[model samples]
Target: MKFPNPHYPNLRYPNRRYWYVPILSALLLLLNGGVNLALMRPLTDVPASMDKLRFHLDDAVFSLFFLLAAAVFAGAFSVLRRERGYLYLSFFSLMASQQFFWEWDGKHLLFGDFPVLPAESLAVKSGMTFAAFLFFRYLQGTNRRLTDRIFIYSAGGVWAMSVISSISPLASPLLPFLSGALLAIVLAYLLLAAGRFAHRFRRYPEDSELRLIVNGFAVFAILILPDVGKDVLQVLTGQRLGYLPVFWEACLEDTFPWALMQLIFVFGLLFFRRYMRVLEQNREAHAEIRTQHESLKQEVAIRQHMDRLLDALSGSYRLKDLEHTLVAEGRRLFEPHSFHWIPYNRKARSIDNSIDNPGLDSGELRELEELLFAADHGLVPGEILPGSKFAPVFIGVMGREELYAAISPKGRPLLERERFALQLLAKYGALFLDYYAMMEKRISELERYHGEQPWVGKLFMQMAEKERKRLASDLHDEVLQELLAARRWLEGSGSADDPMPAPERMRLALDNAEFMIRETCAELMPSFLSEHGVIHAVLKLADKMRVRADFQLEVRTGTLAAKLDDDLSLTVYRIVQELLNNAWKHSGAARVGLDMDQEAGEIVIRYADDGKGMDAEAAGMSPDRFGLRGLNERVRLMGGSASIDTRPDEGFRAECRLPLKRTATAPA
Candidate 1:
């Protein structure tokens, strides 16, 4: 049975591409086999002469060929993507050293390229040799056997001794002894780091691929050992082993190691292929189950968003006075375990009634409230508790600045959908609360203005209505009559302009006078006010005056919204007009801003000036500035409030909040 190996994440499913590992291992075996064959060629040829020609040819050909093949194998191993950290590194080092041995021997000693190749070349060769040793040293950690460590240290010691022997003339005669000692030490260490470590490391749970690699290296080392030993024996004893030169003898001796290497490589292929086949079958069987799991999660998220949407719609209010109902309904829909509507009293350092979560202890509520207030911009419980087992999923601003907290009932972390639904609920709740609060303020202002100064309020309303009728009549009578007379005179004068009657042409003169009056009428008040209602009138005025202004004015209006009484509409228009007049005369502003938005049967008109404002005394002086005083009174009479915000040198802003229901009347 092929069990799942958590150690190999990518290999959880069978992959046909994995066949490359086996194929490459087989090729490496062929290279080693060829190397052995070449080494033995000289051994069989002659007696007493120790097969010198064959031996030399085999050494030259096999060493170069094996080195190149080893390099290719190492490259292939590096690409395996499985168990690569140490296994690939070991193969790379072994391949690199083989190349070094070939090049250094050929150029400096065998080919006699120079006395000792060059100082730089010699140093480079030494560095490569040391690098190979160091890789095996580090690789010891992946393979647990104590023998791997002994192998690394012993090989390192031999290389150090060889260096000492090479550089000193007094030690030059010890070259053979030094070379034999190093070779012997390496063979012994390889037997241990590879052999002993191979068996011990294989005990790691479920990592068969790693075990196969370890076993393969150990087998190779074991197979090559006798060959190396025979060579060392021949050199130390100054006697040929059999019909072979010392090097050639080593090659013949390697027959068993090379054959065993091939066997181990074949075993590795068979085992991995079998394991991969089983892995593929398991994946195919379970694929549908995994897909269903993912689909269910997605469905749950969709349902959550739908729930939030339904709650929002059900709680929305159509009347301005019912905004508080909208808020309450929204709260009920979200089913927040805890809920609080905190008032932002900027004067007090703390939020009021800020706790919104239900059933929490007082201390917990306070803690959650503090965290909510401390949040930057907005806060989500999950973000605050990050990885904590108990964190809230959603936080919201309830009033103008207070936050609403919701913790999931089951104590599970809040999913993304739940958090989003809560956030939407919170946002809508805040908006409705803001509207309700504004309504209350306007009501208070209306009561004060109507109660304390009833006559003043009434007079302000009469003046606004009179101003609208006066401006309308002026356009309809004086301006229209003059323009009509001018048109008729112009038509009758025609081409001659009564030149025959008089050189001054009395008819044409009358037309010019009428035309000027018509232009003046348009400049004073646009006709849309009486024709299309306040919204359209405001838009038309912005358009007509846009060209004359220094900066652009953006006029935006919401949908048809609730209709307002003529008196209320007149108040809005007059308030906007007064603000624009102030901006033009006192503000020195570059742009005029105006916006009208309606929600819950209420209309809000805002106007801002982007220029310097007057002194504080002038800003607050209602008695001195009758326009401001008059604008305030007109809004109050219509059950609304007018607020002027200005700072000296910055600019001035004015807003009029009006209740739509109180002003609902058929258009005049």
Candidate 2:
């Protein structure tokens, strides 16, 4: 019996191809770099009128463009790879891009070109503040609903701030202070995000990706801190500081720091792709393991169910009991909506519907009978009947007799293990039915003859007790006397020059004592009966009888004689021994014929002799005269019949039929 392996329908992992995303991002980055280089002027060719401060300002503008392009590429990679950290990185890049554009316009202001409007400056600052709030909120892992509410409230607040700063004359003076305050808030949020990432890295020390994120956040925060400090100083004093040189101020305050932050973010994004791939692989491996574990558990449960069903069925001895057990076990295993037994009536040549369940309608019952008749032996797969909601399975119990079951409409179809269990149930059911039929017939026969026969139990008990006393007396008188005489002879004075040696005399006495003991044991329970069964014991009995009596004995037996159980074999052997003894001692028979055979589930024994016969009527009236009454009682006790045929001057003939209780070796 092989069980099929369980399959998981939803465990399939798609083979998604993501190899081309990095290749496309790299090509776009190169093209953007080439265009920036083509637009920029040479630094060494600046005119003498242009001071070092102006020259550094032009160089800073070129670097800001490069930094902007890099930030865009990193944001694109984060989006394409679908990293969890992409939201924070994207919003922060937008905030930085707005700040850089404001600085480029400020550089034009330094040369007295006032093309930028005050309203436009306030609007860009408001946009930068909004992007910073969103970036901080997402970094803290806020829920979607709360994040959406924050976005709405912040957008309204920043819009109102921009409108007030543009329309009110007093608000224009406070705009620089407001911008500095916003930059300080953004710097504080960047540090908070870095601290959070650092705490996470400590919690999961094995995750190198978390450590890399913590380092990236810390680096970006440190680079932007100086610019925030410079803005704070300018807002407090209400005047630009002239302590640092122009070149250092342009490079350290904004351009150099922002470019380095963008570069670090781009490299981190590339490493994140590899880390996400590893995480996906781990998830797939864990899912496969869980699936296999579930499959193994199901297999063990199926094996246990089979063992439990077999144990229950093996103990059943009657047809009704077996049917009930099958139904109970089937219900537990299959959870069927309905279950029943359909018995075949051999005499009527049809199904016996009289004892069927009342729940079954006429149409369903008739369809079941038809299916049982049409189906072959063993398990028949389920099929839907004409008016049935569920398919019914027909399992043959014996010949045309079957067990019927219908699964529930919503239940799944039978699995391989369940079908195997049904097949096993059918086989055991058939065997139990056959054995039950034999026992039932034996019981009925006993009931018919029970009233006519004398009570054999008390009689047999009394005879057994008397036989034991006789055996004890024989051992004490014969064997004990021989051993005592031998012991006395060895102790007494020996005569010299005797014909027989003294040791020989003692050995002879011991041999006789041993033989007497063996003979007594044989009479109580023959060795051949226990060793070989009834047929061999009968042959040995005849051989011994031939040596003791003047009659010739002939014995014949069949193959089934070897298959009888120990109790039945012993009883049959005793019957044959008794009949042979009676014929030798009372009938004065010259020859005897003992025949044994099996037919119609019974053992038949026949005995005949050529000797003077007595009157049949006289022997029936006085059964104890030749121990004939005891013999008849023995046969009756075994649910059998015995008869003797005799007449004056004719041979005696007797026949007995005993019920056969077969052993494991018996044919099915």
Candidate 3:
């Protein structure tokens, strides 16, 4: 609801009782009551003229009171803004206007001397009483449809009787009876109102204001009904109850109207006080409800924004795409000037510097990094470091490692709520970045693996070919020469055309060729691998490593399957051989452990060494490190994934999972 004032949140009214208003109203009523007694009782010899004694002491008091009541009701009509108020105003104004006419004639004012006839006095009473009937029902909040029909018809009949009496003297006898009937209707309505208030008083017994209002109404009804009964009795019986009758008339004239005014004044003041207090309370309640509604709207928007951000981040593998999305969404809320990124490692730079911040140079970015590292305060606002352009910075971390961002907002600093949102975004952004980086690294490694597949294949084939050619050269140059010489010696011993040769020399040349052929067979393909399985071959290599390299090699094969395929076994042998070669050449420590397991159609190998490990990025797949690169290629060719974790001081650990289960045919 719109308030009484649009800007002010609450309404203030003069609700505290104006105690003197009712007291003054009562005093005026008593003064008028005194005037009524003086005018009616002391003037026993007064003329009973049709147009005399209208203006007198009672007339002057009536005018003063009517004028005051009219003023009060008119103000009430303005403030109450109810039709019931209008009804009271109409009644009071009619009474006041009638009394004013009684004090003033057509041309001049008359006080204490104006004249009145019985018919004229009766007409005035008829109008004032009609207004009172309407006011009484309206003030009680009664159902007025039936009452309206009854009162209107009754008043009309009374007036009709009065009109007939004015036209013909014969109808004058019925006037008192009609007046008594009208007064009876008013009295009945007052009794009904009193009964309703009494029922409410019983329902809410502790309500002090209600109790006061009910008491006033009860007092008014009791006092006013006595006047109605006395007047009705005189009209019906034509027998005046003369003893103590004047005492009753004086009490009716003085106390009757005063009781009615007392109830009306108290009820009105009390009702207005409660109404204003309720209005103020409603104003506060509506304000709180609106504030809560606004907060709920903000929270919903924040949740939707977070959902959108997560959607953008889910599939974003590149840092640049993620950066662009961050800028766009951050612009929606914060409108920062630019978004800059820096790496924890000073060497690695921002993914998008030229696009996000065109003029910012690398030197400034490094300085920002320095300032962040040197900042003493935590992540609350107003914790700016000296010589820092960023007023608020949100740091992101992954595990123990820290990542960086300059985050120089364009204009003013972020609000506390915005900073909190940014911190949330930054944390999730860092986590997603780590995930994307891992994926990007794997993709690059697979690319390098594929690219090197053919080259690694060619290099191994070239080495095998070179080894075979060297064996062929040795057999041709030395073994063939010895055999030819032994043949010549045999030919010389057999005939005169052959050169001189002994039987012992021929036997020695044959022995030398046999030994050279055995050495070539061993170099080309070890016979031990063909005779034994992959496990035996690996244990043999460990034995050789223990005897020759002084390395403690422990091997576990509890989960390894028996009877590996020829190709698989060859691949495993080469892998173990290359691992040992790298461990012996690069690693200076003496301990190595290898665990081989084949479970549920997959081959898993875990190799670890307590050795001086090398830089992982530098040594894993570098050009010079052909051993690890070749081992990775061999695993890739078998359709597998390989990972090597190494640090400078920590031990090197390598794991390879290869799908090498053989059924009808080996996997391509």
Candidate 4:
């Protein structure tokens, strides 16, 4: 069975051209031939005695050259395992044989004067023959199994023959020929093996090439074997072997092997040409396929991203609930753990309060807001995380707006794809946000217009309630006190003895009138609000509440010497007064706390009660209890915001932030 080529279904390497391999091989062969010629020239003039030979540089130079050649071949075999292993192994074997010749030069130098030592002569001959056998096996592509064995066995035989032949002069003369004959047998094995394999597998191209190369090798061996055999037969017959003739024959010995080596070279050249053609075809197909695949992948990715953007935008609307929905959609689509919606205040050139997705730290939220404010109406994809970290994505605004979404754990700066998608998302988001502002502005204008409406009875009717509270304060401060004073005078005037005492009768009439006044005043505005500003009003109201209403009050105000507008001053004073009344009347509590402060250009009123604060949602629905609504409306009229912070049994806290601007002009 044939082994499959390991580099089968060959693909060309884009980085390296195929022609380099064959060109490199050709250069190496030329270098080998040049070195051989340079070395061979000096050997011709060498004396018979090695010691008598003139100093020539060829021996030392050639030894180093072959050592380098061995190293080169070893490296080359490793790189081109499929094509050059056999060739490189042959080159290494050749180097070893040539090196042996120089190392054992005593036989050549002694010649007939000392006589060629049978051992040395046989050893050198065995090396040459083994090297030739390895080369032939390499060319036939059958060196893997028998090459090392051939080298070892051939060397052993030479060693044994040298020992046996040295015992008799006749056998000593025959040693060289015996070594040559043995080497011929190794070559014959290669040639015959190649021929047998090829005959059985002629349809295989490699087999056919092996057959042709082996035939060339066998023919060379056949020519040299007879010449060598004849010389050995003469020694066995006791015939004299002449030195001059044998030395001369060595000069002619290289021709047959050299000619056969040329034939193997031709086969290598053809194989390389066929491989180059196959490699070229593979390269062209690979390039075309890779280009198509890349284009398709890019196209698909771009389309999918566009689709996601369109889907997000199409579902967006201007309602607050819809804004929330949009944020959720963005988080899901982008896979961000947190999302932000910040309104761009164009006039302020700033961003408003940000609504954030859950699980976000305060600093992260602040950072996102800052990035949104910095953007100039295009996808910023601004980086917020450290240069080395990935956690925040600061998506820029759309079209020079203050709106930006800082997506956390989605990482920043956003990738190019993410930037594009965010731009699309922001464009649609800006539209919805702008619409919400427009609707909110119109509603605000309507509310403000209605508050200033002259039709008092059709209005909130909170004025009637206000009038009642003012009356109650007047009764408590003036009429009720006077009536109590009169009663004290009557008691001091001995009212206990007389049923009709004048002072006592007058005090009773005064008390009835005072009682009637108190009842009527409770229907009007609280007098505390009219008597003082918001902070003073809240404090006085807290003082009026009984110990049954648990209460604590804290009030902070600005030192602004300028007086505020009548409408605004009245609004703040009434709202806090009404909230206090509700806390005292409804919340069955032991304590209530009222805190008022000015911060960030707004007055903040906070009212808290420890009493059973009603369910916020349920209380909000009560038409009878419109105090909270009234407070909200009052703050809105003053261009402020109000938030109720409360839960059942936990108590209630109302926080109001009102933008207070001092009136520049009073009516002259």
Q: Point to the candidate with the largest TM-score.
A: 3
Collision pairs in model 1: 223-257, 337-358, 338-356, 338-357, 338-358, 339-356, 339-357, 340-356
The alpha-carbon root-mean-square deviation between model 4 and the true structure, to one decimal in Å, is 21.5
Report the candidate with higher TM-score, 1 versus 4. Answer: 1
Best-first order by lDDT = 3, 2, 4, 1
Q: Regarding lDDT, does 1 or 2 come out ahead?
A: 2
Tens digits of per-residue lDDT for model 4, 1-668: 33112233232222322354345334434444444444344444555344233332334444455555456555645655666534544454454435444454443443434444445545545555555555444444454666556654665576467657866666767765776766676566656655555574464444333334444444445434534665777779988553222333433332323333343344444345435655676798899899889867755765665566556555654455555655766666566435555555655655555554566566754555455445444344433333322233343333454444544544445554554455556655555556566667777866766677544334368645755675677677767776776766666754567667666567676877766575445324445444665556555555554432455544445553445555766777677777777776677666666666667676777777787777778456355556776677667667777887767888777888777774222111
What TM-scores do the predictions have?
0.36, 0.35, 0.39, 0.30
- Would you list the C-alpha lDDT of every candidate in the order shown? 0.54, 0.60, 0.62, 0.54
Candidate 2 whole-model C-alpha lDDT, 0 to 1 = 0.60
Q: What's the C-alpha lDDT at position 305 in model 3?
A: 75
- Misplaced by over 4 Å in model 4 are 1-72, 81-96, 99-188, 205-212, 215-219, 222-668
Clashes of each: 8, 0, 9, 26
Candidates 2 and 4 compared: the better one by lDDT is: 2
Write down the worst ten-residue block by lDDT for model 2.
1-10
RMSD of each: 16.7, 23.3, 22.7, 21.5
Where in model 2 is the C-alpha error above 4 Å?
1-311, 316-328, 332-407, 411-454, 462-466, 469-503, 530-536, 550-565, 590-604, 610-612, 617-630, 633-641, 657-668
* Candidate 4 worst ten-residue window by lDDT: 3-12
- Give the per-residue lDDT digits (tens) of candidate 1, residues 1-668: 12223344344322232344445445555555566456555455466344543443534554454455446545544655453333433353344444444443334334445444212223333333344455444434434546555555655565565556555556566656655655576556556555535565545434554455454555554555666677889989999876343443334443442434353344435334544655675698679778778867766755554565446545654433333443454355445333333333333435555434346566755665565445455444223333322243333333354334355344444565555555555554445555555666677876786778776665567656655765676567655665565555556743554444432354555666576466556445545566688887766556646654566576677775566667667767777766665665567787777888886666788888778876677777445566677777667767776777888887888788888767522111
| Candidate with the larger TM-score of 1 and 2 | 1
